[model samples]
Target: MVIPETFFAERTSLLKASEIRELLKWVAEGGIISFGGGMPSPATFPRQQIIEAITEGISEHGDKLLQYGTTQGLNELRSELKNFMEWRGINVSNVDDIVVLSGSQQGLDMFGKVFIDEGDVVLMELPAYLAAINAFKLYDPEFVGLKMDDDGIIMDSLESVLKELKSKHKKVKFLYTVPTCQNPTGVTLSVERRKRLLELASEYDFLIIEDDPYSLILYEPIDVAPLKSMDGEGRVTYLSTFSKILSPGLRLGWVLADARLIKKFVLAKQGMDLCTSPLLQYIAYVALKRKVIQENLSKIRGLYKTKRDKMLEALETYFPEGCKWTTPIGGLFIFAWVPERVNTKELIQDCIKKYGIAYVPGQSFFVDESGTNTMRLNFSYPAMDEIEEGIKRLGQAIKERL
Candidate 1:
């Protein structure tokens, strides 16, 4: 018996399949060089360390590891996370303000569940993280896209948008930002802008959701700090994942927020998954306690930086003039804008079938559906040779279209 469309909730209609994930399916068939998903390099995974950590955790705390954990997560893991955040310059005075998540994706969903109401105004960068736009879209919020310069979100543009929304009597709930080494674009918000952002949040009375998964993966030293660290009013809700720094397969992430907000997130989380796996939490606890994650960062940064440089070189050598891309300080992606007449969405299938390469068309990343001439290329997952060849092929595809 087939279920009718009416059987599904109306909210389900808003859900769209991720282009990057769909591209992965094609890439799995072999032959295609994919610059689609923002996946960490498998070479960077601390396999030996993980094995040791898992063995030690089970031998010492098998009972706890195997059993169910609290909705707020394992206390040991939270304690470790508090220390980790402190090292990153985020002062967590209490572990109660931390809540472990399955991934940062979960934290995004939780934000939608707890805060978003029908038509609530949610601010996002013009070309934001596609996953985030998809996650928040489920809750039916009015997404206002903000402009950005090389330094990340433009303060003037944000202030103007805020004033316009205020004039229209819109209830501005919060601004969701990837802030450091932002996805798709790979631009970090500068320290000056970070301070101004917090000031604007205060002046306009809105919350800031700082999704900071790529801060630790920088290739060059930047003076920027996490927005959460500068947020003195407790208005910033920070979300980060072990996906980049450690392993995405473990699927461990955490939220650093006010205690009251953490309590609410805990309640929402209980209705979602009772708790993130105790086994996984314990593994992360071991990894953090042993400083495995810390020790592995230099290797990850060095390797990805090389890949990033290779991709940039290929883009320069192969990509036709009139095409432009961001020179990221550190991140897995490089977002490019082709000639105005080239709609990447329309060219993607041809690129895959003919060029034997895949990339996420940038349109989906734009909340306002405006980036038709753009594409986001992932440099972390593909090998050095693949990076060069893939950029070459992508260049040819764009050039032919031009």
Candidate 2:
């Protein structure tokens, strides 16, 4: 089954497996205490409701649900999603502006396919989502890592980078951001900073892709709105998912952009999968109609808040000196920085095989490959007791390495 190296495409070299995904397979085998994947807790899924929705949707629309659908997605789901976006203050004047994705992850890959030419500039946070980095790597863009503070991306650093890029006469294709409750770092952009980012995007004449999957899962009340909602120039493409709120199994997510861009997304998505499954789209349609997602948000917030607190408390009680982690008000990960002497990617193997613990090392998350001393831990997937024990084992492993 092995192919010769000569048979492979040049882009095949960009296809690296996700560290979280490979680690989750081990976690599924049930020996390790995993702080790896950014997975929603099973407790958050509306099991009974999902079962009912699936059954009912099939019963009522068996002819359509079982068949292939349009590439732009179901009229029902897009119509429902339009209202959903409006509720969140995202402007959508037409249902044609929405393009349902198989998942937001697919949107990332499509963005690269749709936008990037080789050597094009794409700005990303210093410690970004590993999957997005991987997805975009396929198109061979020069990923410039923007400096981020606790309150999301630094404006001064971004403006300076933009100015320099302009001086070089290089165009930035788009600045991909998870602005609210960013991945790995779990930082939220301030409202002021959001305005500034939009301002800079306008000034520099670059597009913005706002990958927003975690803004609604707040533990504390934050006033920050999604950048797309604030975008005045139609430059931001707003992408989000039902994975956090409803069910990841549905594989339902969506993108909201200008009608012109939606046309391109539809064309791009047509070749990708034809369409997101009509059956799953029907389930999402039903869930939204019944207000299942809205009702479940409060419960999810409370469950994850307790879990986040437990992990934070455990780190304080167990992790050694010269280690610190983020205190996220929302989102699944707590990014940690250990001693510079420790390369977290190297430390993780001993932690897994020897200490029965796993985490996503931060090096792959950094486009610049500078976060060798960092790691990302997820609290939402594991139980509180597992969080405590896993953090202890992880701390011991880091200490042994140190």
Candidate 3:
């Protein structure tokens, strides 16, 4: 079957398979320890609690649960989300500002569809989420990568780029950031930088997409707030999910944006899925209403923190002198850098084939594709023992390569 590649759209050629998802398959086959994918531990799922919630939800609203829902999502779920976000210190002035998504990933796609014109400028962290790069790539955007330090996005670099864009008379569509417990790097944006980010967005008249899935998972008492919380101008489109707090299988997430954009999101999503599942929304609604998701946090936090600690300790003990990594106060990942002489992308196959450990090479996460010496490691899904052994094996692989 020699099917012509021309049969597919031109944009299809731009897409690449996710290494993390591919590595997950190897992890599933068994003994390999996976530091791939932002997957939560199965131990975090409240099976009995979820089962009870599902049973009760169906018993009460079986007909509705089985029926198609509005593209905007369940009203009760949005209502619950409002209160929930309030508890986390993010307050919305109007209920109309909320739109439920299948997951935060959908919000990313829809943002691309509605806002990105071909050649429109989009800003991203140096090493951003690959899935996001894939989603927005389909819309034909000119991506500009932002540099970062421990405080997250470097404001000087951001302003210099903004000035260059202004000189070129180009308007940046949005600056997408993970902010709290960022993916790949696991660095939380500092409070001052967050404030400066909002100020810069206003100064430049560009929107901000705050993709915050890990803020609530913070292990420390950091006072950093979601960019949306401090957004008085309503320039930030905040996206979050129950994937970390509850379960990914439920596939429920929501957006908090200006009503103007919410209207567009509803229209765009209507063509996409018509609606997110009523049944899945019901599951999240039940979890929120019953406080199961909230109550489960302490346990999820404790378990992941222990695993994160173990992995950090292993890195210190086993990794080579030039190796360095972030110590995340919270989040599923610990991003690391090996010596510049070692390319983690080239090293991964050997690590998996010989060392029985798997991780996502950091190159794909970079919009500019420059992170060959880096890799992203996950601590949430792997057991504590796996963390110790996997890191030890990874260390040896790097040492041997060196």
- RMSD of each candidate? 0.8, 0.9, 1.0
Question: Lowest-lDDT window of 10 residues in candidate 1?
Answer: 49-58
* lDDT values for all models: 0.93, 0.92, 0.91
Sort every candidate by TM-score, greatest first: 1, 2, 3
Candidate 2 per-residue C-alpha lDDT over 162-244 given as tens digits, one digit per residue, 9 for 90 to 100: 99999999999999999988898999989999999999988999999999999999999988877888888899999999999
lDDT of 3 by residue, 1-402 (tens): 888998989988878888988998998899899999889999999899788867877888989988998998898899999999898789877777899999899999999999999999999998898899989999989999999988899999999999999999999999999999999899999999999999999999999999999988978889887888899898989999999999998888999998889999999999999999988898888889989988999999999888888998999999999988998889899999999999888899898898899999999999998999999999999888888989899999999988
Off by over 4 Å in 2: none
Taking all chains together, each candidate's TM-score versus the true structure is 0.99, 0.99, 0.98
Clashing pairs in 3: none
Please identify model 1 stretches exceeding 4 Å from their true place.
none
Error of 2 at 334 (Å): 0.3
lDDT minimum window of 10 residues, candidate 3: 49-58
lDDT of 1 by residue, 1-402 (tens): 899999999999999888888998987898889999988999999898888877887888899888888999999999999999999999998999999999989999999999999899999998999999999999999999999878999999999999999999886999999998899899999898999999999999999999999999999998988998888999999999999988999999999999889889999999999999998888788789988899999999999999999999999999999999999999899999999999999999899989999999999999989999999999999999999999998999998998
